[model samples]
Structure formats: C-alpha cells, structure tokens
Target: MERLKLDYNILVIDDDKELCALIKQSVTKENISAEHCYSGADGLILLEKNDYHLIVLDVMMPGMDGFQTMKKIRKQSSIPILMLTSKNDSMSKVHGLRSGADDYLTKPFDMEELIARIISLIRRYTRFNFVDNHSQPLTYKGLTIDFDSRSVITQNGTFELPRKEFDLLLFCAKNQGRILTKQQIYEEVWGESYVYDDSNIMAIISRLRKKIEPDSGTPFYIQTVKGIGYRFNKEV
Candidate 1:
C-alpha cells in the first residue's frame, strides 16, 4: 500500500542568499515549501513569525553559526534539522550532533540526496520519534534533553546551552546515581586531567546547575557531594 504524503514546510538558514535561492529553485516540488533566511538571527525571527516542519542549516555563518543557531531552535521545537557543513571532518560532525543537529550533510552535496534526507528525518520524527529510543535523555522530573539533537527543556524554558555546558550536563545525566569527582568530571567533559586549585570544573558545574536545577542552592538533579565532588541524584 502507498503511504499518504503530507506537505512539509522547510526553512533553510544559511548566510549565502544565493545558495538559498539555488536550493529553493532546485528543490521545488509539489508538497514542499522551502524558505531561506540570510542569517541565524533572521532564522530565529522568522521562526517566531511562522511555522516549519524542518530546518536545513549551514555550519558556518556570519554571526550565530550552525551550532549556536541549532541550539536556539531545539530550545523551542523538536523539528528535525539537517545541518550543512563545508568541513567534512569527524570533529565537525561530532560537534554538530553534540550541539543539537539531527543529521548532517557535507557541502557540495546532491540536491536530490538532500531532499531525501529531509523527507526521512521529518517522517521519522513526526510519526515514529518515540520516547523509548533509549538514546533520548530526560530529567526524572521536568528537564528533557535530546542527546541526538543536543537540546534542553527546563522549568525556566527551553534553552540551547553553550557547548561546554551541554557536555557537562550530558555527562552528569549519563552518570546519574554515581558521584563524579571534580577531577573525573573535568577529564570526561573537557578531555584533560584535573589540576589542583583550578576552578574550571566548579565554574562549569555552577553554571550548569543554575540552568537545570529548579534551585541551584538546593539542587534536585545535580547534588553536591561536599569536599569530594558532585553527582546527579539518581533518586530524583
């Protein structure tokens, strides 16, 4: 049996207005609406004014760049996002995923392939994107974190956190119920062994607690072990 097709509104956020025009022209087909924004700021503004089923984002831009922009969008909507990048490096892909992009395609890609990915991502998330995906992360209470897309929803509201903070929080969440020493956390998130008297770990933890905890002083998710380190309360 043939599946019923649905119309999709796709917003492409890239600095190259010319490329945007080319994409709009190339991807023109029935049931697909493609709109372009010149910058991340413009994209955010347009999002407030309109609705979209998905987003095609470019990695490098004048101001916000793809990572930063993706974070902001994830804060509000779980709409599938496909990131475009000129750099084909593994690090770039990792960073994009860690920053909240659903999927990524290197630049100079075939328009046809791009279109297909869009359809696939939309269909999967729109219908079959379930909570049991195990890959998904959530706060026992109110927080929700989508690791694949690198987004967070807290009591305050949805926020796209900076890269370091995201890593810190993800590490904490993954290690819930286990006490992670400052040295352990520093190495895990920042990729370096801990040094004495350094406040880098404390700083990141403090900032993260403020964002996810209902009350930083009396944190519910991340608990202070006092003189040892911190741990995400598994009991929460």
Candidate 2:
C-alpha cells in the first residue's frame, strides 16, 4: 500500500520582501504551503491566531527582532523555528539555538540548503503518522506526546524537549507499571548493548521527571525502584 505525503503550513517571517518571495517560491516547489509576515509584531499576532507547522524567522527585523520574537513565541507555542542570520553572526546563531530555534541558515544562503533545512525541521516537528513502523502518539494525564513532532504539551504549557528526554519518556510510558532496572533503561535509551559506570542514567531520569512530574521532588508518575531503576506508575 502507498502512503500519502503529509501537507504542512509554514510561516516565513522576514522584512525582506524579495527574499520572502524567493523563499515562498522555493518551498512551493516541494509542495509546502507558506504564509509570509513582514514584521515581528505581526508575526507574533499571526502565530497566536493560527497553527503553523514550522516558522522560518529572520534574525534581523524591525520592532521586535527575531530573537525577542522567538522568545515571545516560545512562551506561547512550540512551533518549529528556523533562524536566518548573517554569515558572521555565529554568536547570535548560538543564542537563537539556545532560545529554542530548531535549526538555522546564513543569509546569502544556498537555495538547496534552505530547502533541506525546511524539510528537516518539518519532518522533526510536525504532526503526522509515519509508514515505516515508528512510535505511535501517546497521551499521559492531560498531556499529549507526539513522537513525529518530538514535542510534549499539556493544558498548562508546551515544551520543546531534547531528543533524549523525549525518548526516555516514551520508553517509560510504554512499559508503564513495570520496574525497569538502570541497566534496562540505559541500554534501551542509549541503544547500547553494554553497560558503563556513569551517572548519566540518573541525570536523564531527573531531567525527564522535572518536565512530566508535577512535583519532581515527590514524583508519582516515575517512581524509583530502590537500587533498581524506575517505573511509570500511572494507573490505567
């Protein structure tokens, strides 16, 4: 059986009118629908009103600028963001990444590289079912976790989890109620057949718990098994 490719809506936020048109044209060639916003304030408004699969943001803009705009958007949504910066703006690029931009490219960028980044971000951040045997969508409490999107959301907020945190959460939830030993979690999450003497396992567990547990200091969902590993103790 053949599967249909998922349709995605992308928001391009840049003040450069000609460059915006070029980006739209290039993305359309790959069958992605795009919307353009020429101001940072307008971009924020549009984001609040509609859900976009991805956002292509220019680092330099009027009124709010990309960094500030990104920070504002992140406070409200977990949409994928790809930043556009100048070739000499490495420091700002790092700041963008840390501030939650999914990926980035330098201005005077190669069209092919831009296209590739657009495809990559969407693939890692949109809601869709995969045909090649991937993890299914999961819900815990009021939170919905999407493997395809690599994101987690609840009534209170949405967060962009690191890859390891997402994978660990999925693993624990999959085997809910079972006490998985440290060895088991390490091997499963790290994909290593051998064990190493590192506190990495505990660190990852603590990180995951902080996000999903309402009170990580007194966790109920993820309970430690005393000398073992942990368990997802949801009553289902």
Candidate 3:
C-alpha cells in the first residue's frame, strides 16, 4: 500500500544530517520524495534548479540561517515553507513568521506532528491557488488576500503567510463577522473530514493572530467565543 500521496517534492535545508535523514525516511513513507541540502547557499541553488512543493528549513545554520535563506527565497517564490526551531523560542518563532515562513515547528517535535503540518500546509496552499485561479475576492481586516501570491499586505507592511495560517485567515475573512465553531474551522481549514484534536486549531489561530493582529493578547481579527469556536471580527 503506497501511503504517501506522491504529489510533490520536499526540499529540506538543514545542517543536521541525522535529522535530514530521518525526515527523508519518514516523508518517503507517504510516497513523497525529498531533497536535502546542508548549506543555505546550496538550498538556494537547489531552489533555482528545481520546483519543490514544500520546504522544511532549520533556523540555526552555520553560514546562513533559515531566516536569511527564507527571506531571500521570498524575493522569488511563494512556495510553502515550514521552519524548524529550538523548543520554546518565542522570539525566533515570531521572527520566522515575520520573515515569510509558512509554519514553524520546534526541534524535538513529534514526527507525526511534522507530517500532519506538511499535509495541512500543502492542502491549504492548493486551495488558495484554486480560489485565485477563479479570481475570488478574499478580503478581511482592510487587507486583500492574494491567493496566487500567498501573501497579505496592509498600509503598514506586507508579509508572506505560511500555508495553514494563510488558509485560516482566508477562511475567516471569507466568513467575516460570523462565529465559526472549532470543528467547522478544523474541517474547512485543515481539509480533514475527521475530527482533529482542537488544540492544533487553537495553535493555528494563535499563530494567525500573532501575525495579523496589532496585539495578539488583545486580538481584533480573530476572537474566541468562550466555549464555542471563533469569529473574525472585521468590525473590531
């Protein structure tokens, strides 16, 4: 039984040879192919040479860190990117998101969780491109969504969004002012028919808030409904 979807190639740019081998082995089980690069410059060169479905990059690298490489990549491609960082590093996570990473996973993460994130990111990216091909108007928070580009911009600045956050944001924006239950959101944004552990959705929402909200603690874009789900309070 071929388990992996085998739809796209994944490029992993990291200095850790063992981790890269682990990821390549794990991802290959899903029928997906992976390429590895130990240097930032090498990853850039590979990016120029091939088309990758997703990029899993490590934050702490020798010559050029993941952030710098991603920054450079953003100047060319909007491909989905997942960043790997040290555990509980809030500042690095923030900086990674701000630098156009699609998702960030801490080091020593569960392999299952990493695979789930990759799938979710790819699904969201595909959906956004679908909407873009149809020329849909995706607007929220006085910002316009560009499905083709996978980016959001305001008068203050423009930022690239990682896969799931972009889908979550567009989902909420498309349903502005309507409170959506967690299950509904999980099904839609995650593209999963089965129920997921709601904690993942909450984390995704939190990530989205931190990226778009002026203040994540006092968020105006995505608001919780206590026992319910969440609502995109565009009016707020």
CA deviation > 4 Å runs, candidate 3: 1-6, 136-236
RMSD of each: 13.0, 14.1, 13.6
Count steric clashes of candidate 2.
Answer: 0
Clashing pairs in 3: 4-30, 4-31, 102-162
Model 1: colliding residue pairs: 100-149
What is the C-alpha lDDT profile of model 1 across 1-236, one tens digit per residue? 12228776889999888889887875566367789998999999999999887899999999888889988997887677789999989889767755656678999898878877777666555543443356656646888887766778889777788888888887776555445667667777879766764487778778877888899888888888765577777565
> In candidate 2, what residue range of length 10 has the lowest lDDT sum?
124-133
Considering lDDT, where higher is better, how would the candidates rank from best to worst? 3, 1, 2
TM-score ranking of the models: 3, 2, 1
Best of the candidates, lDDT = 3
TM for every model, in the order presented, reads: 0.54, 0.57, 0.59
Cα deviation of 176, candidate 3, in Å = 13
Of candidates 3 and 1, the better by lDDT: 3
**Considering every candidate listed, which one attains the maximal TM-score?**
3
